[model samples]
Target: MKDPKRADFRGPLVDRRALLVAGLAPLAFPGPARAEPSPAPFPFGVACGDPTSDGFVIWTRLALDPLAADGLGGLSAPTTVRWEIAADEAFRHIVLTGEATALSDNAHAVKIEVQGLAAGRPWWYRFMALGHRSAVGRAATAPDAGAATESLKLVAASCSHWETGYFSAYRHMAASDADLTLLLGDYIYEYSYVGERAAGRPRRHDRAADVVDLAGYRNRYGLYKTDPDLQALHAARPCVVTWDDHEVENDYGGLLSQDVAEDPGFPARRQAAYQAFFEHMPIRRASLSDPWRLYRRLAWGDLARIHVLDGRQYRSPAACATATSRRGSVVGDDCLERLQPERSMLGLTQEDWLYQGLGGPSARWTIIAQDLLAASIRQKGRNGVVGHWTDGWDGYPATRDRLLSAIRNSPAQNPVLLGGDIHSFWTTDLKADFADPESATVATEFVTGSITADPPPYAPFAEMLPENPHVKYFESRAHGFMSIAMTPDRMLTDYRAISDRRDPRATVSTLRTFAVESGRAGAVAA
Candidate 1:
């Protein structure tokens, strides 16, 4: 007798004997598998990340009921999930097939690091479990290390607050012709509201209270993953992800909490947040074992070398912070602690690792992917005094100087910095000395605007622009992302903005375009 819970799927099927003959046997999973075929097995959809020349990591979570209060995705026992990767969209040519166990402990999430595949091309993938199949996703492997390549297209986005507006930018990003995506930070917010939803807010978070425990964080991620546009964007392009403050808590630094300086439960809360983040994200197993291993490097042939940095975990506390509020604060030039040389943002260890190789000799373009803006920005604090925000690179001047010196002294060519987290778009010239306009420009920095988060008031931000001559362009009224394309000769970037973030069916347009030529230090209008 057939199991009534299992539904019939007429999709393509692979022969078990043929797979064994090709030495592509599925991995052995123990225990009797409990099937959840009713509410669809893959409710959160599919995602792939951390692409290498040979393979990439593909992920999916089996959710019978995604919004269950237990944060287990309505699963009580272990289940076996089968995955396949094909060279074409149709399943006619299967390259690899494998099976994995989805245990309830980790929310039934499966992350498989596929290997031994061809490089520099796209591959189609899908997941199967108990007569149900997931949506087909597209992923590609990077070109061989040091291999000559022509061009690479990348999309950079950040700060999508679900309660504020719709994720229409992700829908447009999914339709873009890009090879890779970088989700810089603030993927999910930690705040949870009560009573009726706020005015001008499109939606509310899933959990009823703030996320301080493991279950709360898990449910929050579940809610964000349910967004169809976000799922589509993940399925379309292989992503490289890193987190900012909201992934754990707002403006948290090192082992200190932002709200209360000496919160006793902060360590456990941070651990739970890290565990939930690893379980949901498509990162490798190395990140799970070593929590601080988020900083790494990836090579896309000889064209570019992407150096991803983690600036949150091991940093010194913000300078000039009060005893009660330990994260970030605006401090004027008179604050002596803000200019101390001992304060570091990336920690001494990561700073050493980042400065070691600097940039290799192979890649023509060196790309620095990080959380916050690296360039210095001065804004009016109070009483007409000029101050710097301590949450970003400006707070750690010594570390920033060391980083800039490393880039200037290394063999790295045509270095470009990509950043987010200010909720505004900025194109600035990274100078050796921001105090002097005639100082040498070291590199060009492009800061992507938020996807849905509210921006700071533009009038004040614009009023201080004259004080910052290195700032080529600054716009705070738009909500969009940056589309970057790079070749051996030059890199072109387009600031793509949406008409309205409140409307789900918003239209997208290019607000501006800029280019950085080979061996150039600043960006120019393209």
Candidate 2:
């Protein structure tokens, strides 16, 4: 249903201005004639991530003298990419410079992992290629070993549906002072439907309809990157990203497509999606694969260890047939009966790897950066029958239970699960026995809300939360990200909400603050 040959931009491409009342140029215009906007050296903007105390990765895409939308941009020959890191925004004290080649094979994107730097310091970076300059970006390194960090702040967010609304939440996040961003998943959706019913409104960009091939997926990512808010967010902070079901196809696993019988070439389609995903993301080369690598760990000295997991690639199929199932009925007796211990979300190899990482971690906090809700949530549906999203951790009950038990029994200190994907926000106390209301808490989970995606109305979910005892807080309406501050004694999370999505300059507000003490696994209102 999507036209691959079409240009990236749709509709009229022109900037309009309102005339000034005082017989002068509009307020949008400058006071006098100035130099033309320079062709950016790094047209795709700048990004920094995968930070360690010694060094961090700096990234930029070269697009000097870019050509028009025939998919031809810049020179076909490999270009020499150069970058510099400065102690100030003005580049007065340039400290590091490096040269890397941007090849045609990877769309001229340059990712340089600069090492040998001062730990726990802020740095500004920029790129140079083909006689143009990139927009300056800011990045920070982690604290050194045995350093007693007073606090560390990070923003966690996910589930951005571009067609539903603007990415105003990202704009707010870009302006914030968070050191890093943990993007949980649903970076892009892969379905096409006619009329307003598909997105519940008329679509903006049409190329995203049922992305199958590499180009289709690339174009979809390009469309999302074009959003100023999203670009600004990427340019500002170091982001640790992972994918959810929507990145490839909703509720898909391995070779299984959404409608397996209807689409037999799902394996090939998945490969294409994975390739495109690797190309656009700021992930390291080691993570690239024909299928894709899903698990990795990032360390921040003795303070924290972030364990990133891939939930969709090697996961089991959804347990229910209904479009929307409540907690109890979602994973019916038959489905629950079929959940074997061997049925894995992170395959055997990844499981072993995760356990090894967990065992070696002695940080103040072991944060699991994952895609779905780790806690069990049950709610009564309209038919007065209880249901659940069998697609989440609830589907693989045994595996979830094992993982919880591992955390409880492991040497890892203060395990906290950070997730996104349901679009709604939730805070829960993870326990070994969720069936028992007063069960001992083993861990804590904070499920951040979506960036722009519309969560289900608040009224229904609000009424349902009271019945679920483990759930500490739940909100279904707002669209924003979570700001988490971690310390030796406690971890504080602020649920920041955007005032509105329709407006570009929407202000962000802290909706709630919750904290989990060092020894306590449950979160208390801050």
Per-residue lDDT of candidate 2, residues 169-202 (tens digit): 9988888888898899998776655465555542
Off by over 4 Å in 2: 1-41, 63-75, 198-203, 206-208, 287-291, 320-329, 380-385
Give me the overall lDDT of model 2: 0.74
Top lDDT prediction, candidate number: 1
Clashing pairs in 2: 326-387, 326-388, 327-387, 327-388
RMSD of each: 6.3, 12.2
Candidate 1: misplaced stretches above 4 Å?
A: 1-39, 193-197, 287-289, 359-361, 382-385
Q: After superposition, how far is residue 440 of candidate 1 from its true place, in Å?
A: 1.2
TM-score of candidate 1 relative to the true fold: 0.92
Worst 10 residues of 2 by lDDT: 18-27
Candidate 2 global Cα RMSD:
12.2
TM-score of each: 0.92, 0.86
Candidate 1, residue 350: lDDT? 87
